[model samples]
Target: MADTASQLMLGSGLTVVSHPLMYVKMLVQVGHEPLPPTLGRNLFGRQVYQLPGLFAYAKHIISIDGKMGLFKGLTPRLCAGAVGTVVHGKVLQCYQNQNQLEELGSDQKENSSSLDHVIKETTQEMVARSAATLITHPFHVITLRCMVQFIGRETKYNGVFGSIVTIYKEEGVLGFFAGLIPRLLGDIISLWICNTVAYFINTYALENGAVSEMKSYSQAVTGFLASMLTYPFVLVSNLMAVNNCGLAGGSLPYAPAYTSWTDCWRQLSLEGNTTRGNSLFFRKVPAGKSYVYAQKRFY
Candidate 1:
């Protein structure tokens, strides 16, 4: 029972952690409609209307989630949201690159808060969206971890997770939560989605009593449905964290430029990872370097 609770809590925490990234996603989906002046490009090609610099921010955030550390409580997330948004917004305003074209009146159009407007709006939207899901993510993280661990520690099956633990003990610990933090945050944002949909189902179930009678099965079913509803966060969070070098966030060393949440979503939708060359993650090579080094190492 205690184990179950922890898995639930940890799972939920991961979901909570993942919520912030999803905000970028929502903005990416609707944001293109607003930006008539932004020019963007990706691995595919040049785009006239694209999500600005939000993808870089998302990569940074995702990298943070991939590692193992004590300092990553919540401060990094808040800081990232606050600063990354402004940086991304300004960077997104491509008209600045056309500064030589300033006399054409494209750059002088900002009379209000400037490009920062989008950042503020986006950040607040993130907070609101994240806040909405906070109520549930922690529980899920703990629950899932506890569940897997319970089986891992006690069971003797030939499961892949179990085998991985046997082969790469350290990697195994990390892999169990390969995308741990982001997964949690993703779960957090997912509450908004799952709750909105499940509340009705839950109410219906309560009134029915059929599922309720088989309490354990019912709980499992609930967990299953919730997990399914929440997998989008899980998928994206995994992508971000898996590439991280076990530093501030689970960020990959080599990440492609991204425009916004839409780019992030579209990216993981096809290829779910950036790169697996984690050696460059924690260490920075010197100018004339034969090897890389790190002040602190996590594996």
Candidate 2:
């Protein structure tokens, strides 16, 4: 609990510091001097990069406590990046919807949505998009980190900071974003396929009165199906981010530490987890030991 407080403090403090930095960057782009990225600090960033130097450090800080600290920091950054992810997903879905409506010969000049279909589809799409976004946002960060290590020539130390630095040095901005095209392409498919499927499935369940309100059972099923359906994108995205060249593009730079999704899944799977399938409820099973069992289901 104390650690949670500290993590929160760290996150909140970083937020405060980052806001000013963002403002300053904006000012500089608007023709202001904007303070140099390196301010009055000891020596320079070379100390940050020096080999066999105490000054050099691992990209990620590991704690005896494990994921709590890292997750604390990631929560804020993940939320920021999600803004981009959602926009990308939504814009693609919009274009797709447009194309479908055109193919149906419902030119907006005559009639686009049949008013009722518009409202029904709109409601369904919004719910699926929201649910899908939550799962993707978290996994996106986890996978991105894995990619950094995969692409590395020398780990230097495990973590994102070192990897980011290496990427900047090697690829410049363009190279840093090498995998973006594939990701955007995947988004096109995810939005069109996943959204439409989820909407129809959920709509059927609701009309049949399968359950009250959206629940984890449905969400988990949706997440799994969407994940499996988009397996190709998942592979390509990881390849580009970690290897810089994916299967269709070039030979991958590194073999992923994980051989298969099932292998990675088992490694990450929490044993005795009743909550394995459910995201909202997880608690210790009432044994002598603390367990990962679902507060609602076994993990």
Residue 124, candidate 2: alpha-carbon lDDT = 51
Per-residue error for 228 in candidate 1, Å, reads: 3.4
lDDT (tens digit, per residue) of candidate 2 on 89-114? 55556757875787689644433324
What is the TM-score of candidate 2?
0.36
Candidate 2 local distance difference test against the native? 0.39
| TM per candidate | 0.27, 0.36
lDDT of 1 at 63: 62
Provide the RMSD of all predictions against the true structure, rounded to 1 decimal.
23.0, 17.8
